[model samples]
Target: MSVLIKSSLARKIVMALSGLFLVFFLGQHFIINITSVIAPETFNLWSHFMGYNPLVQYALQPVLIAGVIIHFVMGFVLEIQNNKARGLSYVKYKGGANASWVSRNMIISGAVILAFLGLHFYDFWLPEIAYKYIENNPEDATRYHAETVHKFEAIWRTVLYIISFALLALHLLHGFASSFQTMGINNKYSSAIKTFTKIYAIAIPLGFIFIAIYHHLNPITH
Candidate 1:
């Protein structure tokens, strides 16, 4: 079991599975956030429910952190190994002519998205979890749910979120298809699967962007 964990193929498999899990989690998050655009009151209610759910928070928080670390480390390790294996430098690219630009620059987009994640945590998660919940800021905690609505109402914050979501869409465009291939799902039907995945990759991120922009333009009354 230890050997398998250390093996390259095994690492890729684990990364792929964890990545897919994160993808699903992102979908859930995006859906929840979209509620703010539709009905701020409903969104505040839902956010409060999530914030107050100790069981859900305790169970998923650590799991999410672990999955993110594992997936990122595995991806970097694989990239390094591939680079070392190809000792010869190429002046021109031969393959990937048919691949989308996002497919080729997934690492770059992923890095950007990761940086945005840090900012996101700083802007929202830290206040919600660390300051409000951990330090027990009763005032902030009380307004936590409505705080999200106000945060998105800020034009600068909403613009930043829109940019981050755009990078996320690019990252997912390639990541969705590549994760399946890494998990050994590639076959004759792989093309169809990839096409569908790309469509979803586009839609979900656009949904988040639209909501962010909408909320920014139309401030919700708290």
Candidate 2:
């Protein structure tokens, strides 16, 4: 069991499984956020509902935190192991020989996405939970919501979101197919599976980009 845990294959499996879980979470979050574009009031209501749901929070919050830490740590470990095996003098191998560009740069893209997540948490989650719920600051709570609205209204923020979403799409493109392969799904039908996953990868991220643009152009009136 100890040997299996330290093996490269085992680490890859862990990374793939945790990554796939995070992808599912992203899909749900993207769908919920898109509501802000279609109906701001409905979005706010849904957000409030999610915020107040203790059962949901109790179950999901810890899972989310664990998923993030596991995914990030596993990725770094895999990369370090690969680097050590290859040695500093070794030429950087081309992933196109086996994987996509996104797969090769998973660490870089993931780091960027993580940075964005920090900003997102600070701008949205921190205010929603820490200030509104814990600190009991009604004024700061309202300001937080207004800040989100204002941020989305700005062209710069919209552009930043679009760029981040594009990176996310790239990350998903490789991650989706790789996760399936890691899970031992490769076969003659692998091509078809990869194609479908590609479509989903592109569609979900584009959907998020569209929502960002929509909200930026038509800021919601609170």
Candidate 3:
């Protein structure tokens, strides 16, 4: 385990795998959340099930959180290592000449995403924990839709969400294709895969932004 952590190749592989896992999770989350726009009842049903399900709450949720931690931690580690290497090796390394903006500053975008996650967990997850565990409130399956909409009623939060999601799109623009490359996926289909990733990178974050803005504009009343 220690040896693997020291290996840059191994770390990149782990980062790649964890990134792929999060991508799938993000897609699943987007699917469920999009229903809040198209079908509120369906969204409520899915949210209630996920919130109450033992497997999700007890098992999968922890794993997902750990994946987020691992991916970010490894990202920082690799960035630090790369900087040290560059300092030693490249006397006149030009970042703009060598790498694209998104690729060069993944850490900046990642930091924004991390901060957004903190806000997100504060808005939803902590309230949930308080409601269910601390307050010991009875499960109200019908409450999910209203609560979701209420969270978006704040225009500041809605705008922040949109901005964060735009940064998320930027992050994904580089990350999606690079994860495949890190996993040794250079082949005939690599070009096609990059194209698909570019589409997904733009689409998913735009979808999330739309959801936030929609709920903000169409707040529930009474």
Candidate 4:
């Protein structure tokens, strides 16, 4: 078990599993947030439940954080290892001949995604944290709606969101089907997986961009 974990293959496996977990999380998060546009009450109620639910708060949230950390850390490690191996190789390697641009530049795309995530946490998650834990504020389900509205009220913030989501789309375009490949899911269904991944990569980011645009155009009337 220890030897397997220490192997390079093990790292890829862990990254693949964690990446898939995060993909699942992204879909769920988008679904929940989209409710703010169509039904304010529904969004607020679900957001409050997610924020305060004991199972989510204590169990699932920690797991989610761990998954994010493990996936990114392993990605960085693998990239560094690959670069080092390339440097030491006597034969020159032309990576672009084999893989697409996005496949070759996963590290760069992942870095951009990490930077956007930091900004996102600062703008939305941090304030929510302050309201919930630090300030001991009462549970107001509707607060998240206004918070999201205020976030998109700034044209710059909305632009930032669109740009970040665009990068996210690029990242997922490569990552989604790659995860399945890494996990040894190559069969007849592999083509379907790739097709679905491409659709998901495009649709989810567009959905997020839509949400930001909607919030920017239709500010909350408080």
lDDT of each: 0.75, 0.77, 0.91, 0.87
- The pairs that clash in candidate 3 are none
* Residue-level lDDT for 188 in candidate 1: 95
By summed lDDT, which 10 consecutive residues of candidate 1 come out lowest? 87-96
Which digits, one per residue and each the tens of the lDDT, describe model 2 over residues 72-119? 998888888777776641136664576556666888888888887887
lDDT of 4 by residue, 97-202 (tens): 6577778778878888898889998997888889989999997877778877788888988998899899899999999888898888988889998999999999
Error of 1 at 59 (Å): 1.2
Report clash pairs, candidate 1.
none
Candidate 2 regions with alpha-carbon error over 4 angstroms? 1-6, 88-91, 94-96, 137-147, 187-189, 220-222
lDDT of 1: 0.75
- Candidate with top TM-score is 3
Give me the candidate number with maximum lDDT: 3
**Where is the poorest 10-residue window by lDDT in model 3?**
87-96
Ranking of models by TM-score: 3, 4, 2, 1
Report the Cα RMSD per candidate: 3.8, 3.3, 2.9, 3.1
Clashes (candidate 1): 0
Q: Which stretches in model 4 have alpha-carbon errors above 4 Å?
A: 1-6, 88-94
Superior candidate under TM-score, 1 versus 3: 3
